[model samples]
Target: MNAENDLIKLYSGRILSLAGDIPLTERLAEPQATVKKRSPLCGSTVTVDLVLEGGKIAAFGQDVKACALGQASAAILGAQVIGRTAEEITAARDQLKAMLTEDGPVPEAPFEGYEVLLPARGYKNRHASIMLALEATAEAMAQATG
Candidate 1:
């Protein structure tokens, strides 16, 4: 699975990489729903924004200052959840947790872009960062749907 390259690509080519230097103010403007997540251990923070139209995400954005994994997760989360519904977002979030903890099934292909993050599961500190985006995403969806 060329874990190194996959992780590298996740960080380099993914949208999160572009956020490295964006001012916090600029990063906070995209979501119709938003939230701030923090990892007390590493002090990673991510603020996610989700804009929904007719129950589907019309736009997604975030302003984050955190580790590579956190930012990458946010980038992937923003991209993948764009057209999915709130219920789907919740299921995906649950799936992610299961996959990360090795307590349940992993996502199948096409959706398995998440496999790239598998390596992160072993790094305890990285776990929170990786999950931050999903937590924020779920929050956004709940707000949009309710």
Candidate 2:
């Protein structure tokens, strides 16, 4: 198979669906903290706005401008970000990086949904876009708590 075929496999049906399923595409009215992450290579961007209560995320919003891979990552994060803490988001981000760069297993539980991205492992340029959402969320959580 050629590289184009490999890229096609990476954007499987499930991944495309997730990419289109981004849930929180609006900005928060009064977010406690907000962060925007960008991938210089792909020019993909994901902006996260959040409110934290009692050390956990209470409300969240996002504006995602990325390719299918990045959008899928944001979709997963949006689906599960509520009630999450900075620690959890950071852990997920680390796990994702390991998965893409180190032949690591899919991220543990809550993040196992990332298995859909397994095919993306061989494509290094796409990694930055795929990581934008989680990175921004973790940073926003820190700013909210800082």
Best by lDDT: 2
The number of clashing residue pairs in each candidate reads 3, 0
Candidate 1 — which residues are off by over 4 angstroms?
1-31, 108-110
Error of 2 at 62 (Å): 0.6
Q: All models: lDDT?
A: 0.69, 0.93
**For residues 1-146, what per-residue lDDT tens digits would candidate 2 score against the true structure?**
69889888999999999998899888999999999899999899999999999999999999999999999999988888898888889999999999999998888878889999999999999999999999999999989999
Clashing pairs for model 1 are: 31-49, 31-50, 32-50
For each candidate, give its TM-score against the true structure.
0.74, 0.97
Cα RMSD (Å) per model? 4.9, 0.8
